[model samples]
Target: MSSKSINISEEAYERLNSWKKSNDESFTDVIIRVLPQKRNLSEILECLEPIDEETAEEMKKAIDDEDSA
Candidate 1:
């Protein structure tokens, strides 16, 4: 496999190293596995936390309705 080099801050490198499973694994593999999944825009709007209590309740209801439909 072809490979390319990239640079990151020491702190960032430390974070990835912390998550790495083994010495046999490359940082590239670690990053791909550790990266956050993309959120659907509507799901983000519905599920963001620190939302007001009433807004949270509304979002819960919307999710329930979606499941029942």
Candidate 2:
């Protein structure tokens, strides 16, 4: 496969290097492993489990208390 060279700041290089599992891992591999996956709101919402009425009430109460404070 063909490759390209790009420049990064020293800080960026250090930060990326810190994520390497071992000297065997490449910068490209670290980036692909660490980057966040794109997900729509609906996709994210689908993963959430439903809360019980009691837990929901407690959360609402906590929010109300914080608002009052």
Q: What is the per-residue lDDT of model 2 for residues 1-69, given as tens digits with 9 covering 90 to 100?
A: 687899999999999999999999998889889997899999999999999999999999999999999
Cα deviation of 57, candidate 1, in Å: 5.3
Off by over 4 Å in 1: 37-69
lDDT of 1 by residue, 7-50 (tens): 88999889889998999998878978988679889977787557
Each candidate's lDDT (Cα)? 0.87, 0.95
Model 2 pairs in collision:
none
TM-score of each: 0.48, 0.62
Clashes of 1: 0
Cα deviation of 50, candidate 1, in Å: 21
RMSD (CA, Å), each prediction: 10.5, 3.6
